[model samples]
Target: MFDKIFQLGLRDILDSMPSEYVSLKEAVEGKLEISLNNGLKHRFDAEEVRKLSSIVPLYLWSMVRIPFIMVKLSSPGEYSINGSEWDRRAISLILNDLGSVISVGQMELLLREFKSLIFITLGYDSISGIDNDKEGI
Candidate 1:
């Protein structure tokens, strides 16, 4: 069906997304690599990792996952952070405050500040054709 084709197309667009996430603690402990959906390895920036470690509390280091997933909403210039509470808390600390939705300007700021710690992807709604259970896409 056309829906299946559409889902495949959406998934293809996310082929470069990370296959798995690493915790901040793991990154700090020299486990700074993640596998991508395309079977490629992506390494985290050491300096960025150090900076993040300094910004976030020690207690959250283990729970906060690296490469925070930012979902681009269906609306233009809007995004939602997709991750656990710990992940959002770390981001909130970095940004001073984080709302349910973030604007494009905020996204740019986050990219500049946490270049190696964030990943942008299409929102579930944007990729509604795709199944939610699919991992790494």
Candidate 2:
């Protein structure tokens, strides 16, 4: 898994994204939009994303051991995200690029979404942690 993330590098995926500098007010209000050269569009919800930023880096590092432990401790879901040194560098670069446009306060959301995007793009099921079959009692 690590080798895979390394091979797919964030730079190669995000490439050159053309972004606009938005005010902190706009960011916190969830009014920021980023359009990549590949036609991918990201419209951020500040409250939601900001809530996720601070812990994302740590999550990324630990995700390799167990991805969704926080979601369900009993099951803890899958054990994947085996990253490499290059992947670390790629994450740094990606965060740096994100930081340039996103305000410090809003970075958590961005990082959280970014992590999900990467995981989903790499063929991981976005809903893997949800136990749809569980009975509601």
Candidate 3:
């Protein structure tokens, strides 16, 4: 059930996103770069972002002890989840590649972008609304 919904949401998001935001090569390589307002940059590889995407969501859900929750859309293609909202240690666990120099705001922005890319590359069901098992008309 979770997988089904996840796929559906992913497809919907991917279809609506712009062409530049949906890159198979970047998704596969897991290469991400974030530029902060402070004129600094942080680089993340595919493995790092993948780990963050899986870990951060689970951690948040674990705290609430819920199996699933409503994922609100804060923007056109971005979910409401902010990774920077997590504790400093938790954020460090994901952005360790850049050491402990990143701020909460920067991490949050990066996370939002990360989520966008993840949805593009991860599970996608093009036939989300179409039922394949239906009998012939």
Candidate 4:
């Protein structure tokens, strides 16, 4: 239900954008469209949309994978992202991109999480003790 509304809103924005921008961005993004009686609508290549959406999380996870992989290759007690610049940037970019698809407030909160993840990824801190604010959520 929520995703439907979200997609509709995105389509609406895409519809209002100038054709020149649409042709450029949509071409790069591999977008398609359909026409209705009322107006033009953004149409996604169905399989590509599904696959791209699925890969988002994988991209997020990939941000943390390198250090662990390298640690395993070396003799180590356990593989973990104790302090890594890659993790920080990777998580930041992922959430920021996700934020682009949501409302501004939601974007702020997501960025906050991304920051916290960076702190954790680096050895500076971890969320071992604090309970999250469920009401805010």
Candidate 5:
């Protein structure tokens, strides 16, 4: 009863959250439990949940070319002699050397999906009583 009303009010708040957030409006209002990765579950209006949350894609753009990274599109781009087949070999050699020195790594493997991260920020849920402020109060 009370939860339903609270969920209605939180519609705007939930939507304001960043992408990959799972809304609990469904469980509060409609008794639906939507499960996500990392043991993070959300039960909210399935319709609203889809609209409120998004999957934030992780991009691996790690590169060592600091100076060349910002180069614009084709205002006289530099190539190591396009006509020479050796150019490919040379480039591959450079990349291999860089790979040897550079470290490859991942972070927060448990939080695979972005939604799980958002849930972590929000914390987990428990049973609500007449007064949510005090436990068994």
Candidate 6:
């Protein structure tokens, strides 16, 4: 039906997204592989992993997931982390800000500063309208 076709189109938009994420601990310990939605294996950069490990505390190693999914919201130039508190906390530590919503400038900074440690994707908000209270992996 038309709905099925539409769904497939939407899914294709997220084809580059990771199907699963590896924890910081796993990455640091040398398991730096993540599977993409298209069934492709994406390897994390060892140097980036080492740099991230140095910034985040040992206690948070297991809690923080690498390639943090940064969701682009419905609003223009707006994005937010689609992750747990620990992920946001780690980002806050790096950015030195407590805000959940990231602006275009902040997104640019994140992409530049932690290129390999984050993933950018279009959120459901792009179609369903903005919902600030939503939380996920």
Candidate 1 residue-wise lDDT, 18-66, digit = tens? 8899889999999988999989898889999999999999999999998
Residue 102 CA displacement from its true place in model 3, Å = 15
Q: After best superposition, candidate 3 residue 67: deviation in angstroms?
A: 27
**Model 4 spans with C-alpha error above 4 angstroms:** 1-38, 58-137
Clashing pairs in 4: none
Q: TM-score of every model?
A: 0.83, 0.26, 0.22, 0.19, 0.17, 0.84
lDDT of 2 by residue, 22-107 (tens): 33334444545665556666565554444333434543432221111111111233122223433333334444542112233333
Compared with the true structure, all predictions reach lDDT values of: 0.83, 0.36, 0.37, 0.32, 0.26, 0.83
Off by over 4 Å in 2: 1-11, 14-18, 49-137
What ranking emerges by lDDT with the best candidate at the front?
6, 1, 3, 2, 4, 5
**3 versus 4: better lDDT goes to:** 3
Alpha carbon deviation, residue 90, candidate 1 (Å): 0.9
Q: How far in Å is the alpha carbon of 105 misplaced in model 6?
A: 1.3
Clashing pairs in 3: 30-46
RMSD of candidates 1 onward, in order: 4.7, 15.1, 15.9, 17.4, 22.6, 2.8
Query: How many collisions between residues are there in candidate 1?
Result: 0
Q: List the residue pairs that clash in candidate 2.
A: 1-82, 2-82, 2-83, 49-109, 53-108
lDDT of 5 by residue, 56-112 (tens): 111211111101101011212211112122322222333343111111111122123
Better of 2 and 6 by lDDT: 6
lDDT of 4 by residue, 1-137 (tens): 99899668656644543232122123224444534334644353445333333434444433332111111112112122222444434434444542111334433453343321111111111113222221111
Which candidate gets the maximum lDDT versus the true structure? Answer: 6
Root-mean-square deviation of candidate 4: 17.4
lDDT of 6 by residue, 37-77 (tens): 89888888898888888889999999999889888887778
